[model samples]
Target: MDNYKFILSGGGTGGHIYPAIAIANELKKRYPNAEFLFVGAKDRMEMEKVPEAGYKIEGLWITGLQRKLTLKNLMFPFKLISSLLRARKIVSQFKPNAVIGTGGFASGPLLKIASGRKVPCLLQEQNSYAGVTNKLLKDAVAKICVAYDGMEKFFPAHKIVKTGNPVREDLIALTGNKKEALSFFELQENKQTLVVLGGSLGARRINKLIEKKIGFFKEAGLQIIWQCGKLYFEEYKKYNSDTVKVMAFINKMNYAYASADVIISRAGAGSVSELSIVGKPVVFIPSPNVAEDHQTKNAMALVNNNAAILVKEKDLDADFDTVFSGLIASKEKQEEISKNIKNMALPNATKDIVDQIEILLKK
Candidate 1:
């Protein structure tokens, strides 16, 4: 049909937000005139991220309940009721052909109402361990697109499809541009480069580990492009010298991936998926604060196959230096890790996820 309508909900972190946008972009490519609406938590990153991706977004008065007994937790019931009501209103007004959820606080209410209305619904779960929101909506959604195997435990076996996680197309395309990449980063071709990512807000422990290794890295003739993240830029910005490039953010990840010989990063699903395509020897330090410790679970999928390394935050003090040093010094180890991780990449994940959506629409 020339005019198709779809409602998608996912937000909070870039992990949840980027996948939803990627799916939308794919759908738009197939049905150029399709109308897409994104529902996200008001003031969450998706509110801005979705629109920036050129899709219309509606925000719900929703927030995830905290683990601690706080005022926000007390208001959880009221917020849920309000969000459900708002979701119902949006579903009725939009009359979408189908609804999609990528797993976040806002998606819970949106998918629940859409499913209750007998609208076709789909979910894309990026993690090895399912999120609570996705688990709750398992029975309601018509399809579950997953990145890892053995998700049948959390989702209906018949409904689950292993489509992998959608990643930025641009980053994936830059895999072969080594010379161009090094030029963009202003680095010489002879020196091995180490790329560090601590997310947009920075990882406290990763930052400290990098700081401690500053002299070691320079002495070893390794160039550094450290994304210190916005939160800690003030404290770490002074490390920006000829050998060390400390950035608050790196908007051009394609260049970063192209230039890197080795990478150190948090084990978030989005980071893992992107790194798979980048195919460099990566050291993953999974954050302990995430729900169900999913970051480590995400990293283990790579480590189990010898695709990458996992250095738990708790063990970083004792293990980071040793693990990082070993990976850097051994050319064979770097090449082997790079080759394995690249094999795990699903470069067409964005397209594959939209393929599922199209199938659901036809059904």
Candidate 2:
């Protein structure tokens, strides 16, 4: 029992993969003798990211079905069947103590197979709206760790544990002072800093909005830290100046979060969780392109609680100037929001999740 083996399956994006990695890391801390293995779709981000996180991962021959009719859509049945067979083989060979899934198509077959083999299964649903894989596997998993309220609409009340989402360890405790953070980014200490994040690929609409508002920000005497993503770096790089630091990515996010007077971000589950912990006043422009518009739902959960402000893509032109300007002008509003958002953060999320896994192991 001391040498417990756990299999974690989730991928396609960082939202899914990072949570799995975080949970695995926590499990490693609690049970140093435990064995951890990750299962993800072949050729997906998880294949590379999992190894980078120092864990072994196996790839399943699987991918999500496309909305429009295409060759990949037509091949869905073959892929699902192949993935299921391979997953069953993995379950049989590894004989995991428990299977943990973080909700992506890659997790579906693996969790299903592991549960069928009578292995204890747990799922971590990061978003307010459950993913298709998690929903389908809900009946199979012994417990479901969720981030938002009203998830009983998607999951069984008895199985659900409101543990929030696992965030990067570095973000949990921001040890750097604002002075240190500002120096790290080479920004002026006297100027208020506006940090913009649009995920790893760069959001087109967000990039455009930031570009359009550059003049307004400069007039307001705000320094900016813009992470425009790798895809849009070249096009936005010309705008970089002494006051505006534009980059493909920020390796030191703790510094960025510490240095921010305010934050403008996309409402990904991971980002929301991190921002809540960062406790900064934020404006969330949820991406409308995601499945079921879950990003909007994620943002609304905070907005409804007065923890953050949300401006939809369509309403940006009319609302952005007024909303952002008002928030910036009032330190009272900023403090109120910062306090509310920090209250919503579950700083012990990763540990809480591992506690559930320990319960399964004890059983």
| Candidate 1 segments exceeding 4 Å error | none
How well is each residue in 263-340 modelled by candidate 2, as lDDT tens digits?
A: 999999999999999999999999999999999999999999999999999999999999999999999999999999
In terms of TM-score, the best-performing candidate is 2
> Against the hidden reference, what TM-scores do the models get?
0.97, 0.99
Q: Give residue 204's error in model 1 in angstroms.
A: 1.4
Candidates' lDDT values, in order? 0.91, 0.95
List model 1 lDDT by residue over 1-363, tens digit each. 858999999999899999999888888889999899999999899998888889999999999889899999999999999999999999999999989999999999999999999999999999999999999999998999999988988988999989889988787677558788787878889999999999989999999989998998888889999999999999999998877899999998888887889999999999999899888999998899999999999999999999999998788777777888888889999999999999999888888888888888888
Worst 10 residues of 2 by lDDT: 168-177
Q: TM-score of predicted model 1?
A: 0.97
